[model samples]
Target: MFKNIAKDEMNLQDKPMSRFVNFNEWIFEIKTIRAIRVSDYGQPYSAMANINIHGESAFVDSLMTKSEQEFARIDAKVISEFLRQLGIEQVQFERFKNNQPRLHSVSLASEPHKEHKAKLVSVG
Candidate 1:
């Protein structure tokens, strides 16, 4: 019965803004990925993303809605199959599905994710 808090604040209970977190909290570090679903009219993207940090695991529903490329990469089968390529088997799939999984790692200032990506990209 958290009625005193704003609705947006209430949403934070289940979905946190991961820049701040506990030691047990998980932050996905997707090194490289192909794709589970490409951009199709309304769809942004979905990938069988594998986390190769802290612990090794594959997530079936890494819904990355960023326009990382001119077109989305849709050349993957399943999360496990993708992880198998990296010799990372015997891990469980979290199946963390969302239209914007990157939101989990956004800053407290509410900076746009694209701005964060811009810094990592070379313009030369």
Candidate 2:
């Protein structure tokens, strides 16, 4: 049932996909499944929603350095909302044997944040 639902939601094509560069601490390659067309030029552009953060150490350090619980709560809320806007239902943090942080698979769902309507954008 879930497989059918997922298949219905996504459109697969054999054509080559466009890649976008995210220049930050780390390099990210974002690919979009749909093509966006401009009304003025009628040119079609693919969307790539990739983001690159410098590294996990920087993120962990920021979280650890927060002195107040309120600050930490605010930070977590921001991150959660950001992820929710990206169609992520839940986020889990994991660490490897070397203590390197990694993100696990994200389960896609409808937007959970109700306060911000401006952040919602149609990707498909």
Candidate 3:
């Protein structure tokens, strides 16, 4: 499962598969799957799902990050099994797995900022 983080969103290919599954008493509609490259070495794959609980959305990923070390190996069978356990059909999961995981680079332009001088005040 994915945890809330402040990071860039992965870019995926067009026409990704969409499926619905029930999890934790909420209906989740998985919208897209993307193979993310957060670091310069490894690739992180994630599923973007929309929860029907008050129209909330969240991401789900199978990742192991500890002490600045991260690794993940997600394949079709694994994804299929996960979705299968989540009440999604085999066919739908297979389709989701078969969908090409397009990896793209995401970049943001840096905005220039002015330097401000700070005054030191002693608190007694």
Candidate 4:
């Protein structure tokens, strides 16, 4: 037998169904239902990803500049994978039609024109 409480009588916060903020993971599929163009009022727009993850609606935006666009795209995919590894059940990304900072997480060695530069490294 299952017992159900009335909506008004239920105090969810006082008694949480699942208290897992430091931890929560979901193994589900993602589908993109809507494809909306996110752009500024006058200037060109960036990018947007509106999809459903495991039945949960999610939106993702990649704030990138002209030069960092290619890199941002690649990084966005990696970020999604990273979130999955971090036990993220759902993710939502918002697109703001405003001024955004440049992406410079990945950097290369700044050496002289004589020596060979090393590989690319991630920087916070």
Q: Which candidate gets the maximum TM-score versus the true structure?
A: 2
Put down candidate 2 lDDT per residue, 2-120, tens digits, no spaces. 22222123333323222333355444433222212223455542221223322111121222322222223333333433444433454443333357765543333443233222122
- State the lDDT of candidate 3 residue by residue for 23-123, as single tens digits: 56566554444433344435552332221211112233332234354233333334333333333332221112245543221111121112222222232
Among the numbered candidates, top lDDT falls to 4
Superposition TM-score, candidate 4 onto the true structure = 0.25
Clash totals for all candidate models: 0, 1, 0, 2
Score every model by TM-score: 0.26, 0.27, 0.21, 0.25
User: Residues 11-68, candidate 4, lDDT per residue (tens digit)?
Assistant: 1232212112221343223243333223445556443344443332234544334554
Off by over 4 Å in 1: 1-36, 39-43, 46-50, 53-77, 96-124
Query: Candidate 3 has what TM-score?
Result: 0.21
Residues 1-124 of candidate 1: C-alpha lDDT, one tens digit per residue: 0113333432223322122222334433434444434436456553334343222334333434445532122222233333443333333323333532322221112311111111121222
Q: Which runs in model 2 stand beyond 4 Å of their true positions?
A: 1-62, 66-71, 93-124
Q: What local lDDT does model 3 show for residue 27?
A: 62
Stretches of candidate 3 off by over 4 Å are 1-28, 35-74, 92-124
Scored against the true structure, residue 102 in model 2 reaches a CA lDDT of 57
Colliding residue pairs in candidate 1: none
Name the 10 consecutive residues with the lowest summed lDDT in model 3: 104-113
